[model samples]
Target: MNIVGQLAPLAFGLAVIGSGIGVGIIVGKTIESVARQPELQGRLSSLMFLGIALTEALCFIAIAVAFIPFPKP
Candidate 1:
């Protein structure tokens, strides 16, 4: 297989892995914050979702880049 073809999948996997780590950290903190302030559950939940979406978006961008053909030299 072509090197560039191999790289696309590698890049996609790394993007997903990176996003997962980021989402986990954000959600973990949100959970901790909610535990400390039960009444702020609603607000914390929204913030958590926002973070997840942003992180996921990064992965989507990576996927797009991976699929893109390298520019002609």
Candidate 2:
């Protein structure tokens, strides 16, 4: 039971890992782009935030799954 409990969250963690990596990359690139083109910060920031929201939704789904009960044999 302990092993199963541990493994359950691992699955959710794995799901969030991809979204985390992608959000990190997206945020980094957005920062770089804004740095290079400061004049476009207003436009770029909005789109960047929108993308971040979508990416974070994946992690939120994983978090939801983490607390949900799974059927056992």
Residue 34 Cα positional deviation in candidate 2, in Å, after optimal superposition: 1.3
Question: What lDDT is obtained when candidate 2 is compared to the true structure?
Answer: 0.85
Q: Write the per-residue lDDT of candidate 2 for residues 1-73, one digit (tens) a residue.
A: 5565787778787878888898899999999999999999999999999999998898888777777776776
Model 1 lDDT tens row, 1-73: 4668889879988999999999999999999999999999999999999999999999999999888787655
Worst 10 residues of 2 by lDDT: 1-10
TM-score for each predicted model, relative to the true structure: 0.90, 0.68
Error of 1 at 31 (Å): 0.6
Q: Supply candidate 1's per-residue lDDT for 41.
A: 99
**Which pairs of residues collide in candidate 2?**
none
Top candidate, metric lDDT: 1
Candidate 2 local lDDT, residue 44: 91
Using TM-score, give the best candidate's number.
1
